[model samples]
Target: MIDLHGFGNQLLQGAVITVELAFASLIVGLILGLLGASAKLSSIKALQWIANAYTTIIRGIPELLTVLIIYFGATSVLMSVASLFGYEEYIEIGPFVAGVTALGLTFGAYATEVFRGALQSIPKGQHEAAVALGMGNVRKFYRIILPQVWRMALPGLGNLFLVLLKDTALVSVVGLDDIMRKASIAVSSTKEPFLFYSAAACMYLILTIISMVAVHYMEKKASRGIKRT
Candidate 1:
């Protein structure tokens, strides 16, 4: 065993950052995914085309490439603006922002398809009934469509979230000091790669277990009062 008492805190801190990144990305991703799905479902041809392209291109790209592109692209753009403003030094966007944006974009791409399919899975009769009962478009969507879509999308979203949690490890490539990067550092210092990596694995396993419990609770809550088909 390594001297975990003294040197383990760094790893713990990194793991915390990792979890925070995952949750933050998931939230942003969820919002973007819903918006993208709505755009895809819209009657506007251009909006639907744009949204479809976004999903297809993003889903096709490797996660690592996407992260690097977002990370470097964002910084480069900011730095350009800063230089024009007579600030010779670069305006820094930290690892957290880069990691969150990258991971969020990646998650959103997959989520767009999931949400679109879920929304489509809802019975058209529900919308028709709501309209017949004098519900406007907004009311119908919120009261009828949203509820059903959530129920249908929950499983797919949960699966995406689980994958998103694991992908937080990739942020380590950009020096985010997440669990994997910290584990690598620890291994270097202690010359115990297996021990540190195993610890990291344990942390990931714990996260998945907790997520499972939460997802199950949410599923039951969302499906409440709905009868079997």
Candidate 2:
């Protein structure tokens, strides 16, 4: 066991922060993804164009650039807005908030496609059958379509989540004090780059393993009662 040299608790705290960041981003991304998918599927051409532009622009840019843009851009925009309101003080954005916004936007961009594909994969007959049963559109969607969509989308979302988990490290660049940032601090203090960095890697690996197990369990539960080919 490689000793953490009294930085164990710090690293653990950072790991917890990382988990918090990932979960917060996941929530934001899920909401955006649903809206994006809905817009793309809607009959409104304007909504489809807006959704397409969002996904395309976000996906085309580097994730790191997004983080930097949100971090600095938010501060700049807030400061400008504050100036108009006669508040002259400099405005700042929290790293956590910026990180979540940037990472969530990136995640949502990809998740939009995953959700769109999942929504399209459902059989049209099932929808017609629901309508024939006198179910309203909202009711049919919630009662019949949603469950299948969730099952179909789970694997893709699971993969996106793992990527998002790793992307949490990007927040460290903005001084969020996540696992990577904590490790960097430890390395600077103790001058043991290998030791602290390795510890950080281990922590991330542990998180990934746990996430994978949870995802697998969710997938299994979601697929329950479905006949397998």
Candidate 3:
């Protein structure tokens, strides 16, 4: 009974952590995504190869595998760097940072595909028109392509973000005290796996519901003045 109350708070905190992880990853991933999409679209051979490798390698691996590899591998690399600097106590990558990095890497890979499709969807005439008007590539992208790309990509990006948010629960495997982790502790103490797990499910559902609302608002805002069927 007493433990249940505390468990509830723990789960709530974990849910918040999960949301923060998702948002942070999404922001970082968006930058990678835009660059990668541009690379794929560009005629630059080297940039295109790098971008293609990023998406292919990430997409080929399981998300859980990516998290595990990055969490452990990153810490190892960081410790090596710190040791080179002769300040080696221990270099630790906390759960939050690990969670964000893993998710960001995975999300960026997926986002690249979404952005690519959106970029291709634009009529070639638009780019030609911008060029004919003497607008530079950078200016044309910011003034024209970005707006439409964002609008077109929002639906796909929103879908990917929701998946990223849910997958944050898996970060517990790397010892992240995410909601699922806290719930597991509570279940062990209470010997009520069903109850605690069910509660955790509800918490996740709540997050999903909130995301849906936000996504809808965003789609509407992005699509303003553009007709949809």
lDDT of 3 at 176: 83
Clashes of each: 0, 0, 0
Residues 49-157, candidate 3, lDDT per residue (tens digit)? 9999999999999989988888889988988888899978887788778888888888999999999999999999999999999999899999999999999999999
Residue pairs in collision within model 3: none
Report the Cα lDDT for candidate 2: 0.95
Model 1 local distance difference test score: 0.88
- Every model's TM-score: 0.90, 0.93, 0.91
Q: Which stretches of candidate 1 lie over 4 Å from their true place?
A: 1-5, 78-91
Off by over 4 Å in 2: 1-3, 78-92
lDDT of 2 by residue, 176-224 (tens): 9999999999999999999988899999999999999999999999999
| Lowest summed lDDT window (length 10), candidate 3 | 1-10
Which TM-score value belongs to model 2? 0.93
lDDT of 1 by residue, 1-229 (tens): 2457355788788878988999999999999899999999999999999998988888888888878887888888888888888988866767788888888988898999999999988888887899899999989889889888898899999999999999999889988998899998888878988888888898899899999999999999999998867
The lDDT for every candidate, in the order shown, is 0.88, 0.95, 0.88
State which candidate has the highest TM-score: 2
